[model samples]
Target: GNLPIKKVLIANNGMAATKSILSMRQWAYMELGDENAIKFVAMATAEDLKANAEFVRLADTFVEVPAGKNLNNYANVDVITRVAQEQGVDAVWPGWGHASENPKLPNTLKEMGIKFIGPPGPVMSVLGDKIAANILAQTAGVSSIPWSGSYGGPDDGPLQAELNDEGTIPDDIFEKATCRSVEEAVEAAKNIGYDNGIMIKASEGGGGKGIRFVDNEEDLKNAYIQVQNEVIGSPIFLMQLCKNARHIEVQIVGDEHGNAVALNGRDCSTQRRFQKIFEEGPPVIVPPETFQKMERAAQRLTQSIGYVGAGTVEYLFNADTGNYFFLELNPRLQVEHPVTEGVTGTNLPSTQLQVAMGIPLYNIPTIRKLYGKEDIYGTDPIDFLVDEYVPIDCHVIAARITAENPDEG
Candidate 1:
């Protein structure tokens, strides 16, 4: 049931685009042979062309997007989709940033009969929203941090109804732990019993934005206000901050046929200002049993949501207590995915494209060995346990280098 996908549009720029294009070519050469190599279309702004960006140069062909601001080009769903349509692209690859997680992009591509190399629009919407994702994770039996909000209880009937109807949670559905006022936040903090501190988090927050740490009631109001101001109108929630916890994530891939597998994981605890600086696979700090539990939880969540494509299920592991809480599910290829690839020997970008082409995980040659089954088909029961089949052969770590202003430092 594979759909034809001869041409792909890399709807991003820079490293994300560069890596994806390279992987796609490598996958084509190895899997499809030289005569059937997939053609790639890379995008660039006027300024990028002037700089002679590496991705544009690597692509089989390049398209020009407007310069000035990203919204007019890279982040613009209209522009990206338009380019895809114009180029006769069979599939679109939104690497990590830009419009990767924006459900609008996928929804639009779905409508246009073009394949989106990630989760479906509805699945993306559910997982992209922190509040909805947390509730869904809880429903899927994934362990989550104690937090204030609708924990999929009887009181969340209205919210659940709305989600079922629209595939999204409305602003008015914020209940229990979600605080609109400072008073509600204080009560939530007290109820959660944060010995270390409580975090005021915006539901739409990511990459260290829209977050505030309050150690006591005295600072709670100000922190709450700051977070509210940062994300304006976004639902805010309170959660007990796990002190000295290691950041861990499970690399998961699901297919249209309901098959999902966990490809081990990485420890991304090395961070500065809430941004990961280093990442490594086969999280040795966490016990093997606990890590397996994470893998199972991750795979269960993926299958429950019917998510198709490459994704990362993140968690905060308290090594001392051997307890871990689900953080979030990033519904697209992650920037730090190379660490998992290094250990698992899987090319995530190529896998994503294959999944988009209606190929099941059991059929994907790069991942088929992990399942240890020769005749797994679309009609078979979905059970591919990573611990039973996949072995972590090596440990690999990645360090990120960033340029910063000396004055700011």
Candidate 2:
């Protein structure tokens, strides 16, 4: 496992998380330092024209990837990978949040004798898929919205029936179906009150754009339709409409040797328009017993699947019913990963670089003592949105800059 994969190209758009880019660049630049040997670049798609140019100017190297943003289909995979190979990029980093749609890109990179940074292709696929994410959590017996990674056809129709409009779902009901229609979605949303009123959502590339919490039919219709185009336009939609509850997430680092350990859990209950405005660590509602339970669950899944690099196991809570369910797995670096960094006082991305270099996570200890403590979830623990989208622009750390259009950059 000699993973000396330096020079990673972070393939994403300008509209991507500015904070995430900053954090990763901070580490990548430091890793390179004055060596100037290997370069970690942020490759911008056609859509991310302005930001990509600005980013390249701010950081070190940049690539104006002409790759299409409409899901890495036949042409995009080869296009971006070709850019990497042509540019002599050592590895490709798809940024934080989830895996790449071009599953072939990783293998293609490997075959071309280049390294694919972040999680391995298969591991990323499993964790990225909602249905597969649930299956990963099964060995841990972690509760989630009860989901399948993708939607099924006729066989799924009956399960879909259970969520009839205005109808109620019994607590004992297992086996849930993925819904797309506005009507079925509304019924599922209304059932949230009884089911603790929560839902889980995952999308292809738009990581923070898909989640929605609907207390009733109206909310469901509004949210479902709003996100439907993005959902249906793609090959698959990893969405779960369930109860609104506690936001529990555990971050981990694994290696090819199959060592996985929880970095601790963070509660991000406060969010707006799907963006986590505030986040804290140690999980308040999830004390020692639940924290350990969640941690062990995540570790087992990671080992069973031979997952490597950083990943997160998300969960939804029904505080009223006191029931928490496993949500979805984020297969890449997270936007809120910094809070976990702030809490642990550890450089997660640096540790990730080590893992990318074939380092095992055995040196990292489990958070058993952290569980025994009060499990402080972190600071700034609330979503700052009452109405109107604020974006991260308002934050001090965030700098606002105007950029020219696509070709202008």
- lDDT score for residue 30 of model 1: 83
| Candidate 2 residue-wise lDDT, 1-409, digit = tens | 3767657666654433344346555655654554344455655555556434555544356666554534452236676687788878777766542235445667688788777666666666545555445644654455545333223233432222121232222223222434546665554444333243434353442546555554455665666666665555432223345445677888876777756767766888876645566677757666555666677777776666667778787877666666666777776767667667666554665666567777555432222223332322232211111111111111111122433366788
lDDT of 2 at 17: 31
lDDT of 1: 0.84
Against the true structure, whose TM-score is highest? 1
lDDT of 2 at 409: 84
> What residue runs in model 2 are displaced by over 4 Å at the alpha carbon?
13-37, 42-54, 58-60, 67-76, 97-102, 145-230, 233-244, 319-322, 363-409
Task: Please give the RMSD to the true structure for each candidate, in Å.
Answer: 3.0, 10.8
lDDT of 1 by residue, 1-409 (tens): 4798989999999999999988878888887687247889988899989999999998889989899888888899999999999999999999988899999999999999999999989989889878788777777788877778533235433123134656665545436447879998887777666587888899898878899888899899899989988888888888778888999999999989888889889999999888889999889999998999999999988988889999999999999999999889999999999998888778889888888888777777766555555653333443575336556779999999875577887
Model 1, runs deviating above 4 Å: 150-163, 169-174, 372-382, 385-387, 406-409
What lDDT does each candidate get? Answer: 0.84, 0.55
What's the TM-score of every candidate structure?
0.92, 0.65
- TM-score for predicted model 1 compared with the true structure: 0.92
